[model samples]
Target: MFIEYLTNLLGTVYKVPGTIDPEKSFLELEVDSLSLAELGAQLADDLGIEVAEEDLSSTTTVAELAGLLESRGADIPA
Candidate 1:
């Protein structure tokens, strides 16, 4: 669930069409630090989870970010 949500959010942040690949790194996605910060804010606001920009920066991929959000207590649908 979080993966799907993150994928959608990443697409919005990156202004890209189609689904974002979970295995692709942020660098490969061409995400800059400013985008990371914006993504972090959006995650916190949308998920009600305190995701620091540094934490988001540390995440290598969308899947890794989903794992981090899961660890931080984001809801997982079954």
Candidate 2:
């Protein structure tokens, strides 16, 4: 669920094209630090999950980010 949300957010909010592979690192996806920080802000606003930009940056892949959100109790829809 989080994967889907992250993918949609990346594509819609960040203007990322094509399918986002969960296993791929953000560096591989060409997502810059500024974009990751924006994405963290979006997650806080939209999902009520307070994620630090550094925490998001530390995550290596989309899947890891999803796991972090889940660990933080984000209500990701199935």
Best by TM-score: 2
The alpha-carbon lDDT assigned to residue 60 of candidate 2 equals 71
Model 2, 1-78: lDDT tens digits are 889989888889888789999998888888988898888887887888898766777347999999999888899644
Write candidate 1's Cα lDDT for 44-73 as tens digits: 777788876667773478888988988888
- What TM-score would each prediction reach against the true structure? 0.80, 0.87
- Measured on C-alpha atoms, candidate 2 has an lDDT of 0.84
RMSD of each: 2.8, 2.0
Clashes of each: 0, 0
The window of 10 residues in a row where model 1 has the poorest summed lDDT is: 51-60
lDDT of 1: 0.76
Error of 1 at 46 (Å): 1.0
Tell me how far candidate 1 lies from the true structure as C-alpha RMSD in angstroms.
2.8
lDDT scores of the candidates, listed in order? 0.76, 0.84
